[model samples]
Structure formats: C-alpha cells, structure tokens
Target: MKAGYLGPKATFTDIAVQNAFPDAERIGYTTIPDCFKAVINNEVDMAVVPFENALEGSVHLTTDYLFHETNPPIRAEIIVPIQQHLMVHPMQYNKWNEVERILSHPHALAQCHKFLHNQFRGVTLEQLTSTAAAAKYVSEHPESNIAAIANELAAEKYNLKIVKENIHDYDFNHTRFIVLAHSHTEILPSLTSTYEKTTIMVTLPSDRAGALHQVLSAFAWRRINLSKIESRPLKTGLGHYFFMIDINQSIEDQLVKNAIEEIESLGCHVKILGSYFSYHTQK
Candidate 1:
C-alpha cells in the first residue's frame, strides 16, 4: 500500500504516517490539499493530514477542504506528541543568535511565539508551507544565517544542528492527524488504535430561533457523549455557518443512529465524515 502525507519529509504528518503505516510506501506532497487530492485522484491508497493541534486549535485548511471539497471517509486518526526545536545550518552553529531570519510553518511559528519574542525579538519570521520545508531551505543554504523551527526528525533529516530544544510555549503539545480513503480500502494491520470516534458535519436551519439548541438537544437527550463541537463559516454569506461535531460513540450504535434521525427530522442536514479508531503515539 502507498500513503501520501504533507511533506518534503519529516513533517509531523509524515511522522504520523511513518508510525502508523511503517511498511507502506510513503509519498510526500507539498501541501495538505495536495495530499487530499492524491487520495481523491487514486494517486495513493490513503492520505494522512493534520486535523488539529492541542495548542493551535484546528487546522482551518484541512477542515475547510473536507467540508467544501470532495468527501472522503476518515479511515483512522493518529495522535502524535509535538516538540518544536530551533535548529540552524552547522556553519552558523555558534552564531545562531546573529541569524538574520527565522522560518517555519505559520502554526509552528505561533506555537513558539513567546520563545521567539523573548529571545529573537527583532528577527524576521517567515512562514513556509511546512516546517520541514524551512529546515530543508536552511540545510541547502548553509552559508546563510537562517534558523528553522521544526521537529527533531527534521533536524536530523536535513542535517541541521539544534541550537535550542522544545521552544514551543506549551508543554502539552500534540497534533491529531486523520487518514482519508475510500470505504473499500483496507488499512495496514500495523496500525493500532486506543479508542473509536465518529465525526459529523451539521448545518442548522436558517431563521429558526432554537435551531442550534435543538440540534444539540437531539444528542443530549440520547445520552450521547460529544468530544468536540466547533463552528466554521459555510462561506455562502454572512451569518451562514456549519458545525463540525465529534461524538464519542460509533455510527453503528443504535443510540447514535437514532440521534441522527432526530436531528434530521428538525430540518437540519447532517453528514457523517467517518466512524473510525483513533491511535496515540508516544514521542
């Protein structure tokens, strides 16, 4: 089997793929949308992309694409611990403080905001498509005085030297990545999960006074446990939005099925994104 992920390699998504699908062939794409397209186009058996981060909240690009673009069933979820480090080309190991710029993915830069503000106050912070991309750039241009904020694997893969470790502001840093594939595709046996989850997208009826409250009530009365509930703009117009909810029960459960029916009866539309197992990986 072949797996696609957001990468040039060694990005967090890549690491999740490596841990979960160790024996499968790995293909790297430059962006999250590219990974999704690869799966939709049958370029890969499945695609793994980051969904949300503990410190950074949800990845808007991933969520937006899943809602507006093609609908691929989430096959599995992987949770991985995150550790952001400051690294530079070996040539500038000792002169890291005098670096002209710091580069990383926007989320990574934000995660280490306090560290950067306190240490490199005036340094230029540039955003790249992925953290690994920044490390690759610094590696290729050893003569330049630029540092990258990325993971330890990126530092080793790009042959960069670590100037500082664990630069992220929060210690409880973890990212959730989801695998997208058709229902017929069978995931490799190497992947194991700790629990199960079911995610659904809901669109409430407009102009209804208690439409949102009624939607929640459907699940609430059924005694269904909701893990998360977040709103995203439908992008049609002002005040038009949809909710993405994660339920702790599987779609196969009778209570969950009944709750969906109750919700739909109230003139709301619901889309089941997936019902799959979730895996947790240690650092």
Candidate 2:
C-alpha cells in the first residue's frame, strides 16, 4: 500500500506517517490540502494528515478540507508524541551560544515559547512552512548562524546536528493524525472492526428557541457520550456556525444512529464525517 503525508520530510506529520505505515511506500505532499487531494484523486492509496495537536489545538486546514472540500472516511488515527530539537548544519558553529536566529514552523516555534524566552532571549525567530523546511534551509546555509527547531528525524534526514533536544515547553505534546481513503473497508478490511469514534458536522436550527439546547438534548436523552464538540463559522453570514461533534461510540451502534436521526428531526442538518479507531504509538 502507498501512503502520502504532508512533508518536505521530517515534519511532525511526516513522522506520524512513518510510524503508522513504516513498510508502505511513502510519498510527501507540500500542504494539507494536497494530501487530501491525493486521496481524492487516487494519487496514493492513502493519505495521513494532521488533525489536532495537544498544545496548539485543531489544524484548521485539515478540519476545513475534511468538512468542506472532500468527505473521505477516516480509516484510522495515529497519536504521536512531539519532541522539538534544536539543530544546525554540521559545518556551522556547534555551540548553542553561536546561534543568532531560530527557525521553525510557527506552531513549533510557539511550542518552545519558554525555551526561546529564557535561553535565546534576543535571537530572531523565523517562521517557515514546515519544521523540515527550516531544517533544509539551515542545512543548505552552512555558514549562517541559524538553528532549526525540529524532530530528531529531521536532523538525520538533513544531515544536520542536534544541538539541543526536547526544546518544546511541554512534555505531553502530541499531534493526532488521521488516515483517509475512499473507503475504509477497501483500504484495510480489518480496520473497519476497530471503529470507535463517530464524528459529525451539525448545523442547528436558525432563529429557533432553545435550538442549541435541543441539539444537546438529542444526544443526552440517548445517553450517547460526546468526546468533543467545537463550533466553526459557516462564513456565509454573521451568526451562522456549525458544530463538529464526536460521539464516543461507533456509528454502527443502533442507539448512536437513532440519536443522530433524532437530531436531524429537530430541523438541524447533520453530516457523518467518519467512524474510526484511535491508534496510539509509543516513542
């Protein structure tokens, strides 16, 4: 099987893909939408895309594309612990004191906030498209006094040396990546039985009294546990938003199906995003 991930290589998303499908043929796309497009166009058998981060919250591109662009079923989920390391070109000054500028993706840079403030106080922080992109830049500019905050895999991939390890501010940092395909059963029949989550997009009844309350009541009366519920604006007009809800149980459950049907009966629109299991990997 072939798998595509967001990359120039060595980004957190790339690492997750590597962990999940180590033996599959791996391909890298430049952006989140590209990965989704690849799955829709069949450029690859499957695509791994970052869905959410423990520290930074949901990846907007991933959420938006999954909700509006293409509604591919999520086959599985991979949870990867994130560790950002400070790396520099081998030929550049080895000492951390020699670094004048820090480079990484914006989210990665933000994740190392305390480290940047306390250690590299006056240094400049440059944002790139991806942490791997920053590593590539530092590797190419050997004479420059720049360091990249990326994963150890990035250091190995770019032939750079890690000067500081685990520079991220938090120890519990993790990013959730989802595997998407045209059909889960077609991609991997065994995974279908592992389904544990049912995500749905809900648009509530407009100008109706207790509309939001009624929506929650639909699930509450059925005793269906909600793992997550977040709102995103519809963008068509003011005060128009949709809720992305995750039911703890699989969509195949009769109660879960009935609860969703009841939600729709209340003049609300519902769309099932996917029903899949979460896969956790140890570092």
Which is the leading candidate under lDDT? Answer: 1
For residues 1-283, could you state the per-residue lDDT of candidate 2 as single tens digits?
Answer: 8888899888887877766667778899999888888888888988888888889888887777766865578878888898999998888755656698999988899999999999999899999989999999999999898899999889999999888889999999988888898774355422223337888888888857788788888789889899888888787788878888889898999999888888889889888888888777775
After superposing candidate 1, which stretches have Cα over 4 Å from the reference? 189-191
- Candidate 2: the clashing residue pairs are none
lDDT of 2 at 214: 88
Q: Rate the local accuracy (lDDT) of all candidates.
A: 0.92, 0.84
TM-score, structure 1 vs. true: 0.97
For each candidate, what TM-score against the reference?
0.97, 0.93
**CA error at residue 4 for candidate 1, angstroms:** 0.4
Q: State the lDDT of candidate 1 residue by residue for 73-92, as single tens digits.
A: 99899999999999999999
